[model samples]
Target: MSLDIGDALRSGIDDLTGEDGLLVGSVFLLYSLGSLVADESLSAELLTLVFESGAYTAEQRAMVDSFGGSPFALGVGLPAAVVLVVLVALAGELVRYWAIRSFAGPAETETDAFGDRAVMAVGLGGAVALTTLLFQSVLPVVGQLGGVATTLVGSIVGPLAGLVLLTVFVYLRQEIALNDGGYGETVRNSFARFMDDPASIVILLVVLGLFGLVGGLPSLVAGLAGGDAAVAGLPVTVLTRLLSTVLGAVFQTLGIAVVTDAYLQVRTSARESAA
Candidate 1:
């Protein structure tokens, strides 16, 4: 009982354009802020590292030293970074919410399961943040220590592992969004559903990977373009960042809908097979 990947993608697109635009819009705004802040923090860290590496003379070092300790740059933008994490979490949550509504039918009342959804959002967001932190901090150190083989293995394994984990998350999130379920119920249902029809996991990963690849082009172009011409480059980079964020939101919503649709179809197929 194979899932209808094409139909799921079509439904996903329709959901984003029709019913889920506002949710996707909010996701874009939140994701853009997070991306911008994360970039700024990374730039500050790089500048500091360059200064500390003694690549420059004392005067030159002094010039670059300013990059190390601005209010926003210092401690990696502190409260703003914290806020960005929350925003990222929200972005993750809204996509799932939109998907659940589209697939399972919208909530009958505005107040329906808001609290539970918040819990699910926080959980998903925490997982997202943790995954990122490990990729940023742990992976590099491990790569350096393990050399080329380790780096190569990680490059292959990391994304595959992340994809698997993400599907699990999606499974749980679907229950949280669609069912009036507790954490326990969500966990059980997600695991049960996936175990019953494992192929949908692949479907989800492929769909998300394709969409993410397409969505990431703007950021790639932005980073590649924009030479030292600060006047030309700044606006171009800024616009591209904005565009990337918007694309990100679009795909996030689309991914959720696609996965949910896959899940629903898979569930039906599995049930029919059992019958």
Candidate 2:
């Protein structure tokens, strides 16, 4: 029951164009901000490395630094973070919706799982934060734990946790539909589905790899260029930083889209086979 990759992508694109899809995209955009906030330390470090190393000009560095230690920064960052979280959530929902639509083949389901949607958005937002923290702090400490097991567990846990979260969302959606249930039921179903699909569990890593390849590279290059421009002149640096920030957002959005779409495809095919 392998699916056509092209059809799957087309369905996802079509979904992305609807009013609900736009809402989903908007939510994902918000949700992505949560990811950005969670990864602030990493973002900061990366920016510093890129800018200070002649990737950007001193003026550009100064502008980014201006937000430092400002109370208003929180006000600005919070809204942005919320938006990012919503974006990720919406993207995930779109994928799941498409997966269901694709598997069921033209059968329409009620888009009424508000509880499940809320739980998914909040849960995923938390997961994003936790995953960010784990990578930033836990993994480094794990490296110092001085054992192969500890190192290996530390290395894999965060990503695996993320994969599990993704699977849970998919599982919960289906289970809730089947059981006439809500959030708690969906959560339980998510755990069960993850356990049932080790192969698809591994598929997450592949999906993420592809995400980095397609969605990450453009921004990486953009950052490099922006950083270089920033170091060269003040005006150029300012523009460069601004452009790079937008570029980062775009890349993040696209990355989520790719991951959501691909994971949905995998989940849909697997579910059809199981049935």
Candidate 3:
């Protein structure tokens, strides 16, 4: 039997409820909030440095310095900020492993596998981070070296390539969580799985992307209206950030559940065919 995209979506919705759903949701919430704090803290530090450099006029310096006093400003060193971000990312991946296992079914979701899974999650997360950094770092350089024509092409191709990589890594995470394979094997299998049914994966990705865009509208509007400005006694930017964080967490959980269910269906079909 081929994959039924609608059925997979329905299954995902079902998986994203009850105790397991709450567990996943909570972890994602913390993960998103941690990320937000880390990002704002780093931004604050950068702004403070720029203001103190004496490049800006006194008025500009004073304005930026005032922002340095905001609650998000941590005065953390770059090394410490990076470590905090890495820790948050690892925590996110750990919960992702648990969510995938739970969605896969009870037999695959073994309590004793925590230690092994944590190690695997670290490997998987690191690989993904490296892959993303490589693409980001390399693509811009490649574009620069080639001149305006190449830069234009890169502008279009870069995002498409990034999306494809994102899809592949999402499957890679599923593979790692569901199987007891080494890093290399998991990576190969994820690519192979995508090759087997790229259309479905792309379709699912588009659907999820649309959902994310819709969910982010409130934040977008808030930013456009005035990100730094206050609205009715509340900080619009902070409020929007919190709203976006919550919405992002919910959508991320749903997306993972959907992908996990879809992967299971494909794997089951492949097994039956082989049998």
Candidate 4:
């Protein structure tokens, strides 16, 4: 199947840039909140929350509080971060659904509402998160089997595994938005679609990765240069972040829209070929 990469790219950009500011603003807000919630700052309340959750005994919790909450405590911190990630993902899925439905002329609405799609988002996020944890958990075992070649390969394997899992997540999440099925049904159906044209999954990941790399360049350079760029006596980090945030918002909004249209087109072609 020949995908008109240029046409898809142009249409996606037009749809995203043609929208009002609200979509961009919403994306920025979600990304920003995710960064904020992931911060490691801890407080007495956080200490109680963390310790109270059984990271430590009751006596330990009390003792930790006696140190003026210490400079380090995170009761519920990790849990809160996890919840926030799910929330951000849910928000992204809602954006994807609303954008695809309105912009792509899907003309179908089986599971269109945000509430209906929440389970799908959680499932996607959970799958990705679990893939991460599972890979991390196996590192010790990998380490123990250490030969030089084995250790060398193991070092990059986790990240490579993550990248592949993420590609799967990207494809499946778009299906969840476009297909309008329950989580299990979505997974089964989407996997079948994936099997039909696995190349499409690779294409999706490459396009999305290019978008990310393009959007992230300035920040990337700054980080490599030590996060201290300046423009007109203003901190470069501030300006880079602002620019990156805007681009990230635009990239995500367009990425889903473009992929949704492409997915529909691909599925239609597959059915025709099958017949």
Per-candidate TM-score against the hidden true structure: 0.69, 0.48, 0.79, 0.65
Per-candidate RMSD vs. true structure?
5.6, 8.4, 5.0, 8.7
The best candidate by lDDT is 3
Error of 4 at 126 (Å): 4.5
By TM-score, rank the candidates, best first: 3, 1, 4, 2
Using TM-score, give the best candidate's number.
3
What is the C-alpha local distance difference test score of each model? 0.59, 0.46, 0.70, 0.57
Candidate 2 lDDT tens digits, 26-133: 555554444444445344443433444464467855755543311112333434544544454455544544434333332333344544344554454345445554
Which regions in candidate 1 have their CA more than 4 angstroms from the true location? 39-87, 107-111, 136-138, 141-160, 229-235, 269-275
Off by over 4 Å in 2: 2-6, 18-23, 30-38, 41-184, 191-212, 222-228, 231-275
Residue 147 of candidate 4: its Cα lDDT?
A: 48
lDDT of 1 by residue, 1-275 (tens): 45666787787777667745556556556655665566455545544554555545798555443222222333454355545555655565655565465555654223355565766656754565457544553354344335568766555666556655666655666666666556677677677777765775666577578878876786566545532223443544555556766777667666766777766776677657789
Colliding pairs, model 4: 49-75, 50-75
lDDT by residue for model 4 over 117-155, one digit each (tens)?
Answer: 656655674566556643543342243344456545655
lDDT of 3 by residue, 94-170 (tens): 77887788777767443456576678777776667545633543354345445568666665677667666787766
Predicted structure 1, TM vs. truth: 0.69
A best-first ranking of the candidates according to their lDDT comes to 3, 1, 4, 2
